[model samples]
Target chain A: MSGAVEIAGVGLHRFGRFDGTSVVDLGLVAVRAALADAGLRRGGFQAAYCGTVYSGVAAGHKVLTALGLTGVPIVNVEAGCASGAAALDLGVGAIRSGRYDCVLVFGMEKMPAGIIRSSFFEPWREEAGLAVTPAYFALRAQRLMRESGVTREMLADVSVKNHRNGVHNPDAMFRKEFSVEQVLSSALVCDPLTLFMMCSPNEGAAAVVLRRGGRGGVEIAASALRSHLPGSVLGEHTPLSGLIDDTAPPPTSLAARAAFEEAGLGPGDLDLCEVQDTDSARELNSYEELGLCGVGEAGPYYAAGHTQMGGALPVNASGGLLSKGEPLGASALGGIVELYRQLRGEAGARQVDGARVGLAHTVGRGANASVVILKR
Target chain B: MSASRPVRDGLFRDCGDGTARLLGARCADCARYHFPRAEVCPYCSCDSCSAADLGPRGRLWLYTAVLRPPPGYRGVVPFGFGVVDLEEGVRIVARLTEGDPARLRSGQPMLLVVEHLHDDDGTRVETYAFAAAEEG
Candidate 1:
């Protein structure tokens, strides 16, 4: 295990469509802002990591070149939607290994308009019409609903809650709230999942600066990543290949367990959290996987104000990806940025009270789940 | 007119006696099964995988309908699909022949069919899928 690392700065190019901006431009915007936020001079970093998908080769080098922050060993990472968290994990590893004191990590994406294209499926599967991205989310949603008693109304409530939070987050894409009726009445993308319940693939970027032994910022308590186990199915966007491993633990649970163990804390130790709300149902399922509530308890737990603002363990206080359209690679980092701000008491309007320790989680298409714990 | 072909080779085979079966790989070392075919055992990493016949029946484990067509998919709008928990213990994602997505339920019996997926050139590319079994 490596030593500790601290986030010195965090920045984001607001989550939404940027019609004329290239992915590199979005990345540079976030990177420069993060450097400025950290009060660090350019070209002073030992290395850099860029997380993205569909952004061609050497994405990190391209971004650095635009910023004139070159000459560093820049590496690009792709882990479906968990790309950003994976990059942050790499940065933390570098700092703890005593190889680099300060490192830059940024994630950006500019998905073509429409349903996000996923190359994770085989050609035959694609041809069978089993490759639509949201279709998998809906399948998982139905399974979670049947198993957990999570109602369609509860799924809509997730949209309502997150969108309400989005109104306060100027950086969020959709800053408007809707009633449960409105969300439920929205166009049905798939059974039990509505248009308003799922996030759109748009464009955005978020960047973080990590420095070992840094003072006065959030400490990285733990960063853990786990791939899909042989048999478990939740959070897996990969095509079903063979016999299901019904006995293995879900990747999120495994990642969360490892993170909490490394942090020497439990779910109750968290003050706030930002989870992968790729859809409302996903957030509900994550509640169980992250151990925020006992299995089959998310519906009641969320209804009782446990996840709302000013309530215990408020989740998605930055409106989540549901309100902040997912830009794939940048989605995880966006959640991290929200938590980082909440930990520092810097989040305006939507800040969690007395927030000290926070968790940010994301699960990608490749069945990779990441959990990061931060402490003030 | 052109003859139909399986989307990929080795998915299913015609027994030349008016009967067909889905092709799966069974591990000789561990007795586990895999859908489609496996070159090696995914569980024990052993190279003792061999072809086995999986019948055309299963139970619906989970399902969903795509209201909009995905890129490169030539299927009609509002198509349904799900995982069929085969009797052989392997679950596979397949398009449902059921037109209405609302009526499909979990644990319902399902039957497999090889149907035209799309047309590339003059060939009717056929693929395997599962549908709700007809009530007797």
Candidate 2:
């Protein structure tokens, strides 16, 4: 595609909890690093987009002005966990539309310590004890296990793998590994899903610089986002309003299909990937949704170790959201930053060798899903 | 006498006798039902929808027990959250009277009941829930 945009530079302020660091501080670090990496000053960009959920209005404007990079259009985007990817889509769109040659995109968030307070559900639901994010994940896990014969052991294995990989990722919040036995025995957040199996809400920031036409950096072949369809009930906090259609395609599957078609590539052509592993069971479920494996096959697929760093298709090489607690708006952008490092062979100990094409997927509480494909 | 109130009005109505029934919105165009009522049809987006009494009967579809209560929740910690598929083709999310996760099973028959969610300064906030149906 002639309109394909290239990722000129990527930067990240390590994913973790910074007790005293303001959201703007984390964002400034990432933005300056990205601009420096791109060999351009902050004033060179035509526009700016910031992705965040909890941060208040004009978050982008505040972040840009702190660096004296003002007088440009700044748009703030919020799509639950996919906020970062949605903002990246805007940057890519602007560049491809010939509106501007270079655009800056940054995603940052400082989340509260306990369970995520999602206002997406009515207050009654929250009072009824149905608003916990992990509760929905556990419900999906129970159904998937009943349908696929997947065991809790298999789910723990996903955590074991991702956490072990996290040890190599200095940017990951939790850089410690846990055994399968340790995972299954961890604190139970919900039935069949343990505390460590789920990603906690925390702080972090990731930024990327995009250019209309570039020769060196990774090319963004496809950047697609899709929201939940009517009659769809699969999301973090969506109310169960319409008739339940168990067979309807979820937003992630739809977005992935669109990205693959746009990129002229299929799952088999991908060398590695970074997906929304908000929880371990989610990673297994995503294997089916992303076409990495068939339905009811992710359990066996993980047990066989096919998704490790050296496996057939390594996923979450940056240790995933499970290792780096989700910073709502910055979650998806973190995956893209990881993919950029992987494509450039700069992932240090977690590098996936000869990785040419990588895909990043993130789904949010608003029932929005984004899939972006990058090729070296 | 203290008044018994539904958490959200129009969600259900008391028969003035001792029993209450759920209020669902039925679409005249698409023949689908919505729980907790709706102004417009969610399926067909048609305004041809009206409130109807959804008799309290459905089968359990999926469920999980919350180990900890969420903010603003005064219900017992570790309460069961479930979805019951009513005969009207709509799935409603509600708390299960069955607190134990192991006792709950998909496809089990269920019946609705109104219980106290929390006390707001001596005012009992009544909310609807589903329990394992008694065998006939």
Candidate 3:
């Protein structure tokens, strides 16, 4: 856009089950850490944007009020799992429009343990067993397998790689690595997708401080958000909308194209990526959607080890949602925080060496897809 | 058997001949079909849509089985569901009578059927589903 916006600081509350911890408290930890990292005192930032899905009304105001950082504009945003990125999109736009110099952006969630539920589907759909999230994933996975020849083993391999990478991330919820066999053998949540292949809905928080001018920090190269086009049907994130149109481009492709164009960079120039792995199949689907690989080529691309930690164009070096667990609101921002560390060469074990550019993507509720690019 | 009723009115109609047809709307402006019957056409933004019956028998686009019950769902666990392409070119998501992945394949001919979903109170709540055409 207009002026360069840099991530001044980034922070996270370890993702996992924090039983008895209030969602507000979980957000407080991440916000305080982010402010302290940015060397900003209370009320130093001009505004705050909070992203959440289940934290209830005025969730951002609640977090800022607890820190006595009220009186400034505090807006809460929701766009399914892309909530945090949506908030960042707003904050970045505000700064580019010369509305504010410095702003605080954070996302937090204490998920109601188990499957994620959304009001996007009609009551009848849920009653007819047509709205189950896992079932949707499985359906997509089955189609992917049919079209792209992606096998169940390839899906399991995705889980294994992410879990292996998650082993090095202290902020990740499940840090232990699992073998492909284990992932395949784990309880089947739905046909073709096993328990370990799916990302758990859990609790966590992540935050970032954004400033107008770059101070040798990671610059926000581009931020783009896109919604599903009508008649995409299976091509979109949400279920039961429109008719079958295989030609319809998914929201991920739309958002990725916009972000790449804004940054004046293509997929070939990226050093790494952090994409939505809400399920293992989603990761593979993202590879094709992000233009990282040709259509129907993700299976062979992963088989070539091009997405592994030390491999070229590593994806999900932060373990993705697979190991980090999806704390809806915080999921997208958490990826940003990871990219911030990698771009700054601060990511210890999971760091992609000499990484200068990175991309973070998240698709929420099958409707909103966001792509954010960062550069050193 | 207890009294039975459709899960929600206007979704599908069961003919006395053990046949069923999905109810939808066809946009008079763009001639596009919408499942569950929308009052307006999403593509053309035209409100001249009229009720249309999507004939039974289409190709199964995709299918899956839910191993666990979704929250607030009163249906049986591990139910089969799929996206079916109707003969009218409109795609619809509905439950399938088949849950076994071994028995299901993409592009298989499917026919609409009205079946029992679950027992709500004392009545057998029914809903629309798709079954293999050969199974019919």
Candidate 4:
């Protein structure tokens, strides 16, 4: 906590699909906006970090080259969906280490249409149909329902709440709200999960400028990232990695603990949160993993209306990925951008009133989880 | 019927009768089990592993019916996938014979069977799947 690093500025390109926009264009817009917001001219930042999955090699360099901002150290990082957060962690670490007084961190992605095809699995596994993401989600959903009494209605409620919040977020992709009936009745992608319940793997870019020893701006209290431990078959880690051992904690829980310890604050100290809602069940599961609610109690906690807007601690006030669509690399950083705006009192209609402390969580395909805490 | 064979070699094998057993590896150092076989134990991080048959019976841990075929998948649409906890203390993700949710339940006994997946260039490809065991 001694070497305080603050989110000097944050920016984003609207989260949605643009047929003709190149990935470089998406990233250029966000990076330029961030530089302007930070009040930094050329030569202000000493280094840059870019996170992306499918944007190809030298993505960050391409963006900087386009803007004539190349020359400083530009590094690219990827951890599946947590790509942005991973890059942010590196930038925060650099600033904390006094390697750079100021740095740029950004992420962008143009995800392929249809089900996400990860080369993470072997071709034989994909051919056998065991690598489908929705199927994995459904398997987890079914287990959650049995163990936690989470009904399909409760799942629909999460969609309803997040989508309703999305209506106020102009930057989000799907701004329309849907009722519980509509959510549940939407085309079934997998058993116990409808298409509406899943976040679209679309396109977007998010950027954050971090500076050492800043005041007034949102301070990055903690940035912790953890990878999955071996032997957690039932856990949220990638399927087929290990055997069943529920005793092992998922990466989210590990990252949350590390983040809380680093920040010297717990979940109760946060005024609001932006958690991974890759799917409705995932959001609820994150509640338990992040310690926002006790294990197996997320169902009741959510049912009590504690996470909705205007509730005690509103979650996903930026409409979350469920509405914004996941651009993978930008996904985690998008949460940080939302938290930054909320803490700065600039989040228009979806603002969480009197917000001071906020936490953002993102788990990626490598089974990596990142937790970032921000405070005013 | 065209010639059918296991989709991948060394994963599971037909017992020459009607039964199929998954070929797995067990760690000599930690005794942890791994499906699809592993040369090194991920749990113990030791190379002291030996091939073993992961018995035919396991309990269904969870399941889901995929309404659409995954990318690059040539199998039938709406196929069933599940996590099964083997009697050998290993958990594995596999294709299930039953695709309908109503016909699948957690904790039900499952038996390994080699079944047809799809036709690939005039040849029927077979893969290992778990079928619900009849109850008394």
In model 1, the runs with Cα more than 4 Å from the true position are A241-245, B14-20, B134-136
Tens digits of lDDT, candidate 4, A1-376: 4699998888899899999999989998899899999997464899999999999989999999988889999999989888899999999999998888999999999987668988887898788877788888887788779877689999998998999999999889999999999999999999999999999999999999999865767899999999988777655456663566557788999999999999999989999999999999999989999999999888889988999998998999989999999999998999999999899899999999999999999997888999999999
Q: Give per-residue lDDT, candidate 4, residue A207.
A: 95
Worst 10-residue stretch by lDDT in candidate 2 chain A?
Answer: A232-241
lDDT of candidate 2 over A1-376, digit per residue (tens): 4676998888899989899899999998889888988887646999999999989988888889989999989999999889999999999999989899999999999999878777786887777666777777887788778876578988888888888888999999999999989999999888889987888889999999999866767999899999876675545546654565546678889999999999999999999999999998888888888888887787777777789979999989889988988998888999999999899989999999999999999987878899999998
Candidate 2 iRMSD in angstroms: 1.7
Residue pairs clashing, model 3: A237-A366, A238-A366
Worst 10 residues of 3 chain A by lDDT: A232-241
How much is the lDDT of residue A320 in candidate 3? 92
Residue-by-residue lDDT tens digits, candidate 1, A178-276 = 999999999988888999999888899999999985576789999999987665434475555456546777789999999999999999999999999
Better of 1 and 2 by DockQ: 2
Which scores higher on TM-score, 1 or 4?
A: 4
lDDT of 4 by residue, B45-121 (tens): 89989999986888888888887888768888777888888878888788888989899888899988888888888
State residue A177's C-alpha deviation in candidate 2, in Å: 0.7
Chain A accuracy as TM-score for every candidate: 0.97, 0.97, 0.97, 0.98
Candidate 3's error at B131, in angstroms?
Answer: 0.8
Candidate with maximal DockQ = 4
Q: Compute DockQ for each candidate against the true complex.
A: 0.66, 0.69, 0.70, 0.72
> Higher lDDT: candidate 1 or 3?
3
